[model samples]
Target: MIRSYEKTDLEEMVRIWYEASVIAHFFIPASFWASQKSTMKEKYLPLAENFIFEEEGQISGFISLVGEHVCALFIAPEMQGRGIGRALLEHAKTLKGKLSLKVYKENERAFHFYKKCGFVAASEEVDEYTGCVQILMEWEQVR
Candidate 1:
């Protein structure tokens, strides 16, 4: 089931984010992800429109959106490949209809996954904070 993110979900959500980030963003240092955990919990997640995917009484995945921009999407490492990310993204789609996000150019799985989900890469730029090239992707519901 998809549900709104609540205060109680912070810890688990950060756990999922950190674990997935390490695996998917191997180009970045693991320490960088560790340093961002608290910020993700205290700052980013609280500031976004977050959705939690819970099943069998556990949160399997989640997505965070700030307006039409998707800020984050992650699934537990053990729980990946089961379409949870797509499910969470679809829930966001139903809410916003049109969505946008930036993906690290090196994260091929994510870039292709977003493409498979109908997002098209519109442009690319270097992220000042990470010194990594990012692709700006957008998806809109067909009218």
Candidate 2:
């Protein structure tokens, strides 16, 4: 069930982040995981107002949002492809305005996921940390 993040869930959340990063290493470097963790905490976490996802009563996966931008959406290695991410994205659409997110170009799974969810590629740029080209996608809810 999806709900707001609690202070107690930080550890589990970080674990999910690490696991997701490791999975991403198939296309990027393992070392990038450390930098990604730091960025997630420093740049995204603080701005995030809500973090929610399905938990097996044990905090397995999570989705965090900063305003209308999806700052993070991660599922534990053992629990992905179970509709958690899609549900989170759909929930985010109920918020106030257009939603936007930056995804690494190499992470084609996510790029296509966002595209499948009706987000259009709005821009492209290089990421400073991994030196990977990144795509910025956005979904607007017409009034």
Best by the lDDT measure: 1
Residue-level lDDT tens digits of model 1 in 1-143? 99999999999999999999999999989998999998999999999999999999899999999999999999999999999999998899999989999999999999999999999999999988788899999999999
lDDT of 2: 0.79
TM-score of each: 0.98, 0.88
lDDT of 1: 0.96
RMSD of candidate 1 to true structure, Å: 0.7
Global lDDT scores for all candidate models: 0.96, 0.79
C-alpha lDDT of residue 29 in model 2: 75
Where is the poorest 10-residue window by lDDT in model 2? Answer: 38-47
- Tens-digit per-residue lDDT, 1-143, candidate 2: 87888767776787788888788646777777866676666566656876568566877677777677777888888878888888877877876478989898888898998999999999999988778898999999877
The residue pairs that clash in candidate 1, if any, are none
Score residue 115 of candidate 2 by CA lDDT: 95
RMSD of each candidate relative to the true structure: 0.7, 1.9
Question: What TM-score does candidate 1 get on C-alpha atoms?
Answer: 0.98
